[model samples]
Target: MCNTFPAVSQVDTGASQHRIESAAALGTLVSSTASYLTVLLSSPAHASASESLSRHHAQVLWDLADIDARTAGLLARILQPFLSIGILLMIIRIVLSWYPQIPGDKLPWSVVVKPTEPVLGPTRRVIQPVGGVDISPIIWVALLSFINEILLGPQGILNLLQRKIDIS
Candidate 1:
């Protein structure tokens, strides 16, 4: 007996097309990232960080933060206070958070909010607040403080580099 039903054509779900597109996008992303890393690993003068740092006998602090010793002192001075100021702003934001009635757009509050929002906005999305309270400000404070201690503290990376520059 012959079948009476119409033969349905296979549907093109575009899975193969999607996969090809996805693979191409991923390859492009990888290539882009590799190029970026290549530049970052290399110095402003196009020298490797390891290669540049090797010239110095003082081997305590070696990182991507400073590739040239000429700028180490300036970097330390600027970065130390930058981190401190970040922590201070976060603290002020934390205090501002305590007073919910204060409008964020007003003077003083706006000054604090404008600077800290860029940081806190992304942080809140990544880490949800505990209980009913928002803790991003506090978290940022801790992060800045920790960074300050790590890169600018006594025996810190940049501080050591700064010392190295001072000695030479």
Candidate 2:
């Protein structure tokens, strides 16, 4: 008996092609809209009065410029909340370090110290106390601050990634 079906079926090829074309069209539309909005919103008069707004809009334009930049921007946005939490926890830990007798089960205060021990323990071991003061919390705050800068600051990894994406 001879085989009737071909190795590669042509079924749905037109549909797939149409889907691909639609996706390309949608992408182009989105990019064009972003560029238009950037130009419309980035007038010097508006930007000069609101530096934060200007920076935010500029970053959005940068992210929309390429896939890698967009991914980096998205990652940075997702990580921002966690970074805020980390900073808050570090601040609490620093306060806790000032008091040696606050029990972990202490009401109201436990909320601050308990959540931060896991983060502080390793640093405490590595950093050691400075002049009889536990400096681990401060160290962690500094480290987390540094990490926040690397990942999300204006001249951060995302910006570097955007530059690389543009270069390529």
Candidate 3:
């Protein structure tokens, strides 16, 4: 049955070969440590045994504290919102794209032709072409990429790891 599929057989054999030794070593260490602690704690000399157990417990707690610190630092680095500005810009652009323009009501040719005063009060008459370019999306994506790759990329993970190790 095992030999029927060569790929499966090979993978099974390889996995067993590679992992079995490590698994056995880990199991042995765990069992031995547990047995030792149990024996140490269950000894008749309660004071000495309690002190030893407390010391071992404290060491374990310290190790766990270090691990937590390192993990938190790594997560902080990885989860930093580098693309937030770009994302916000993109959202604004999307909203603007959906904006409804004011409808122009039809009027007499004379009224339409005549240059009316700007309704919103005094304004400079800059002869800009109607429906110019909208490059907000492009700018947003470019900025997002820049921030993600430059400001937050190299330093994030490395700095996180360094800080974690340093604190530990």
Worst window of 10 by summed lDDT in candidate 2 = 1-10
Q: Is candidate 1 or candidate 3 better by TM-score?
A: 1
| lDDT tens per residue, model 2, 1-168 | 111111111111332121112334336545654554566567666535466445545544432433355556566778899888989888887777787787867878778777888877887788788899988878878988999998788888766765563332
Evaluate all candidate structures by whole-model CA lDDT and list the values in order: 0.60, 0.61, 0.42
Cα-lDDT of candidate 2 = 0.61
- Per-model TM-score, in order, reads 0.59, 0.53, 0.25
lDDT tens readout by residue for model 1, 1-168: 111111100111232211112333334434544454465466465445555344321221211332344455566777877888898899999888878899999997898899889889999999997986789999988888888888778978767755554222
lDDT tens digits, residue span 1-168, model 3: 223222222223243221112333334434554666777767787556667667665543332233233444444455455366445545444344344352223343223212222311122133322366344444455666766654346564334433554321
User: Which candidate leads the pack in TM-score?
Assistant: 1
Q: Candidate 3 — what's its lDDT? A: 0.42
Q: What C-alpha lDDT, on a 0 to 100 scale, does residue 166 get in candidate 2?
A: 37
Record all residue pairs in model 1 with backbone atoms less than 3 Å apart, i.e. clashing. none
- Give candidate 3 regions above 4 Å deviation: 1-79, 88-95, 98-131, 154-168
Please give the lDDT score at residue 102 for candidate 1: 95
* lDDT of candidate 2 at residue 8, scale 0 to 100: 12
Best candidate (score: lDDT): 2
- What does the lDDT read for residue 60 in candidate 1? 15
